[model samples]
Target: MGQDQDTLSVVALCQSERVLWMPDGSPHSPRFKDRYRSRSGGLAQAMTVFLAGAGLPVGWRGRNRFSVLETGFGLGLNFLCTWAAWEADPQRCERLQFASVEAFPVSAADLVRSARNAGPEDQPECSIALRLPVLAEQLAQVWQGLSPGIHQWRFAGGRVQLTLAVGEVQATLQDLDCQADAVYLDGFSPALNPQMWSAQTLHLVAQHCRPGATLATYTVARSVRERLRQLGFSVEKCPGLPPKRDRLQAVLRP
Candidate 1:
């Protein structure tokens, strides 16, 4: 955490959320009754499903600043992976702004552990796996004092910004002021976390996006696709990462 602003709540609310580690060492949400990321790997899912699906690294290339709006923060592996990718790319955008909303946030310790367990996406010796644990540590340090309702932090000499909105999906989305260049629509399964994928929620998400902005998600539910399509997004079902039959990508038509 480089710089943060507007402390609205205390860490006490963090107790309402509970997380359990799967036997495979992945983080699972007891409340959502789902794993935060694919058991195959967190970094892998972050890179392939969300980042690449949204055309990132490539999408952010040629911009002075890039904004990403993520529906589910989970263990924050996606933000860490995105930051790592930006740092590694020579043609990266000059600044990155990432805003994620989570109804229930896990402990800081889990963030680091999730990063450590997120692997085999690439070689452990020299890949994103090595970088995420260190990045997670930095995130955890800031997370220790985290409360709720819109907290902002800067990383990488202020080149990277994180706006963490903690609350229900729809309300938090409405509260966050972002004209996102890209979006990641991720959370528990639509069957389980229906509100996150509900029509009203997706409508609010679309309202925050810029014209021609791109969106991605790990789910390809029919209702989700239709809801997004109805919202004026050009939705496409794309090849997914392992364990997922298909993922979705979309663009907000101007």
Candidate 2:
């Protein structure tokens, strides 16, 4: 679609979700009744569950560019963590692209609050919190312009790029046309947010996966695993972060 047409089509905003800060400081979605990130903390979950599970840093090392597609943007913790990782790595890729879809975008204030609350105390090994506040501020500056369509932002001297599609899961995935090197399947639990884990939605996601692209998620739901398998991904269960038994990882087959 043309840029103007696409922008006009997305002018109608999806109602933003009400984000409630849990007693423990984690952000929770009232609509889904689910935590945005694990209680293990945003940075830790992004690293261990999404980055490590997808063999990031290592997978992207020496490459000219690396791109990741995420199902849910949430407070953008995953994007921040990934950007931090790329900046910290000595042999990082020349460019990092993070594309995500959020049906209900949260407010900029909530984004800042979420990062501040996700501190070292929540996950001691998570040093990314040190840079989160600044990164969050940068994201918040552009958050206000976000509409229902695709919004793009550049950071770190244009080394990092974030493309966010604000709309329904399936439609956004279908609208995106980029080859993903890694995919982070994060939203609510399958039982609570089934649309994000549905076979049809996953198939749309798979359409953007390049050969051998890796995928990871905090949930090891049988239905999710089966859907990935049917989509030609070699799915496997891996040891999860604290308080969680297992997480799912997979690689698209050539």
lDDT of 1 by residue, 1-254 (tens): 11111112322345535678878787787666888888668878889888998998899999999999999888899999999999989999999999999767778888888888888745867567789998999999998545668999999999999999987777789899899999998878999878789899999999999999999999999999999999999999988887888989999999
Quick one: best lDDT, which candidate? 2
For candidate 1, give the lDDT. Answer: 0.85
lDDT per residue (tens digit) for residues 174-220 in model 2: 88877999999997899988878989999999999999999999999
Cα lDDT, all candidates = 0.85, 0.87
Give the number of colliding residue pairs in candidate 1: 0
> TM-score per candidate, in order?
0.92, 0.92
Residue 116's lDDT in candidate 2: 82
